[model samples]
Target: MMRPIYLLLGLILSLAGLRAQNLTAPLLSGSWQSTYHNPAMVHFLPQPVTLGLPGLANDLRLENLQYKDIFVEEGGRRILDFTAWSDLVDEQNTVQDVYSFETFGLAVQRGRLGLSLYHRLRVEGEAQYSRTLVDLIALGNAPFIGQTVELAPQGEVVSFHEVGLGLSYALTDKIAVGGRVKYLVGTSGVQLAEGGSIQLRTAEESFALTLEQDVRVNTVNALEYERLDSFTLDYDPTRLSFSELTGANTGLAFDFGIAVNLDRLRLNASVVDLGASIDWTEDVSSFRFTGTETFDGLDLLEDLLRDTISLATAVDSLLLTYEPERSTAGFQSQIGASVYLGGEYDITERLTAGAMLVLEDRLGELQPAVALLGRYAVADWLQVGINLNHRTGIRTNLGLHLYASPGRVRVFASSDKFFTLLSTGNTALAGVRLGLSLALGQRAAERPGRSRSSFASLP
Candidate 1:
């Protein structure tokens, strides 16, 4: 029905406005959250024993679109403004939304050896669409008569739970290495298969439109399909259960990192979420549509508006013309993977500067990002830093990070795009990371050979 289609569109727009993972979290010196990006960072944390409680250590990123793209001021009031959006959007845009939560986590260190265990929940979604699709939605086929409008919008949603174990060791005073192995359980997923395309061509004379489409919706524990003794019914996504979000498939993943400390300079590198895949076998379903049809634009619109023909009936007619199919079969999905390299130089006892390069694979494309960072230790218990970033399609972004330790308790937070928080217009990307944990260990000043173990004292 039209209601479901509208709901899906609203959900996509909301999800597209957010993104995930804190690229700056790993730069914190004494926080256990740093180990998330580079496990070797455990060697630099001041805590010998750390406990991360639930609802903490959260990271989210939303990119590609902003507030100004969706709303505009009209008659002194803000209103949904698709015209404003059309003016800002490009021919092709990709939206990414990701969120992660660390439910329960712990890390312990003994001499040169460190160990960690944690459970996490992660949700990721992405959408790629052409401007023509938006134009068709907002302006309708009348304005697009005599031309072909390509509709190739595609996206996927995935949710999974992970249990991970990490090990780190100092091979030498100047070198440390670490790796994490994770078991992944997929809870729910929806993806669009390849060979899917759509085109709408409207004739100038009669205003008749020809619709051609080939779409496949694959699901894992996110839909229900029935096959009776005599007849088989199509899958119903609306009947999915909440238990699907707990997990319906299984897989494995790993992260590897290494750090080098020398004089006033330090270097670190990591490969994260590497080679992760989930196999959806239980309750899997695939629904497909492949056909071409012609309709008088005016008649179709009038019937849709007057309720002469139900939306479901019209869709059914289209599918019946093509002999739509459904299948219950297992399939595989890969996780988004990333690599990071960073270096820092100590300019003074309380001041340091660094640079980082992040290479991430998204939608079959490699996106490279660079950030220049500066941090100052205001006190033994307080550290703050700022980052200036540059990436494709994004010219500049200012980010901030803060870490405070008060009475053996550590609190850390960071954002990659802080400008979005200051403006009411949806014109920029934004993200935030926050965490709280208890630290138990000898003070940095009381430890023996503190200079040899401290990154700030490398010189």
Candidate 2:
């Protein structure tokens, strides 16, 4: 039990090293990747043909906690300490980790019409809890004696592969609209519903406790089910093979966006990952506990504080008092959704400024963020920009973006929190976004003496 907990914590810490969506990608006007943020931007691609190979584009975000919360300096050394870390946790907290990678991408444009297709893999996980739960594990329930430690914990993990088709067209010279349809193949998932809690109260010279738990774990592969079964029988999970790839779940989703061009100003808006849900129907299992039991005259508190007994031993003894029922059932999980709105102004022939607003839903809560941007076009082959952003519960962060269309190949990269790269200490946020692609056909905005009017037409 301690090993699994440690492994989970290690995984979370490692994932925290990478962070959120490409909030600055849309500002790279000529790059094909811009379409990912606002599909309508496809109409603004400088090249007529674009092909992105596997591992070219990636985005990740951490919704809760930060580097400092997971990695801390103790006694002149930095280490992963959950017990020390629990002191920084809020009374109510939610942790969300999302990762998306483009496996294959392509885009083609002719005059006012544009088309795109891409394959991607996305994994998202979220956990919500009350601080009391953390204290139960980090400091033990000795401090909350005689009080009900209300525990309402919920979490879910889902991974799926997606194939998306997008289409965009210019309506006159000022407006363009686009939409994408995505087909998803779910590979794995686990969800915890609301039905568990623990209450510990200390009596005169002993401790009394009540426990209740109800949870469900789901997966696409039958081997995962066998692994859980093996754990219940022999407490050995290493025998489980987790490399199998099988499609046992499926779903559909869509994205809609529009961009408007007006003289020296451009406005854009889009809603992505809307109406996405996964249904787990294969290799499903559910466990539920609904009875109450009390322990009397047990020196559980002293043993817990003194390390005289292991937490697993204490839990196993309690479980023998009342066991939970295990069964099989199907369940559904929803994907995180987001909305983006942006505007940009051409201050000069070689300079532009912009602002964007983003609203993302995580764990049934809406998280809002804003960014201010400045870009300089050094040449037809090079462009650079900086973004200053602020998101709820996070400190202001700076980001950098570079788009280089050197010869027939294009390369681009952006990070929402670039300053973290130079920090020797821990950061509150971190992220990286980059991609490489081959481009061909006439350069749409590269004609000699073409006025800035054409270059500023869309953003």
Candidate 3:
């Protein structure tokens, strides 16, 4: 029972770490976009509480994931939920845990074609904390076992800075075809922990061990030791410092994507990100706690150091030790699609209403989501818009878009959870959107002699 409890505690912590992984793979069917127009940068930044599109007009290029609905059909939610919890234990052993937030995207319209860009921010990951803890445990024992322990530990934080340039040509009034070339720049900070430690428990307790280090990790140095002897001793608490146990390095990486779309119904497919990798700068750290071994049993001092040294060595070994000037990192996957449903309708002479059903794929899994968009022309100079979005579970989103023009200013905000949930602070999201977009370019056709049709002509 005690063992089960320890295992349960470890499992819980491990699953908590999985929150980071869940944050990395984003789905397009969420409602926050009405306020920010993008979901790629959702990890690090707060939702765009304000829209700031009014100042200038130029192209903003940005570059930018799962499945299991089958179970939902067969009442598999409970099963999946149980499995997800069990899987959390398995995930605990993995070396990387990635999370993301603040995802936003935008597209520009030009005649028959539209160009767009998006980004995924705050993608961070590191070697499992449990592995670090384990490594420290083996280090305290030395020659009695006449063995050495080695591990290759690594970690990093990266953002998928993506740039996509798209072109669409309208084949007819209601039908069009388009494609885009996507580019990704991966910026990351990395750390690697590697080293070895040995301990002599007792002569009669002759146990020898050697653990092979993983090849992918770049460990700067290894600890070598020969045990002397053992004796009883009191524990000492003065040797721990947080600073010596950590280090970090920074760098960059790359990826590519291509997508295509059609009219009121858009079939957008692309390799979300391709050929992403991480290159780390080297930075190293080392930890040591020395004391007399207890002959009367494991000394309290020895036991504490045993625990401390294991953690210290693992952390120091895995962190950025060499500290390169910079490093690079990112993830790669195959092509996926988002089928967009246009939600535009005229409710009255001065009002228009629209909605969209968004279906998308991430890393091979499919997700279906829906959105509602409404615009009311309060006057020639002012317009008010509202958006409602829903995807999986009971999560619902609401957004408001307000525009005041001459200079054409826009302010917006949205909630990613039910209003009641928000009021109770049960969800992670809160607040409104406020932003502005200015039309800085005028077409020659809108000047005087040229008709608006000239600008509207098929591409």
Best by TM-score: 1
Tell me the spans in candidate 2 whose CA falls farther than 4 Å from its real position: 1-20, 55-65, 72-79, 194-205, 219-246, 296-324, 424-429, 447-459
Q: Whose lDDT is higher: candidate 1's or candidate 3's?
A: 1
Off by over 4 Å in 3: 1-157, 189-339, 360-364, 403-406, 410-412, 418-428, 431-434, 443-459
Cα lDDT of model 1 by residue, 78-196, tens digit: 44555555666788876666667677788887878878888777777766777776565555567788898877567776777878899988887778899999988887777777557
Q: How accurate is candidate 3 locally (lDDT)?
A: 0.31
Question: Candidate 2 lDDT, tens digit per residue, 358-457?
Answer: 9988777788978899888789777788889887756677888777777877777777778775573322244566777887776555521112344222
Model 2, position 53: C-alpha lDDT score? 61
**TM-score-better candidate, 1 vs 3:** 1
RMSD of each: 5.9, 5.4, 14.4
The models' CA-based lDDT, in order, is: 0.66, 0.62, 0.31
For candidate 1, the lDDT comes to 0.66
Location of the lowest summed lDDT over 10 successive residues in candidate 3 = 56-65
Q: TM-scores of all models?
A: 0.82, 0.81, 0.41
State how far residue 270 of model 3 sits from its true place (Å): 9.2
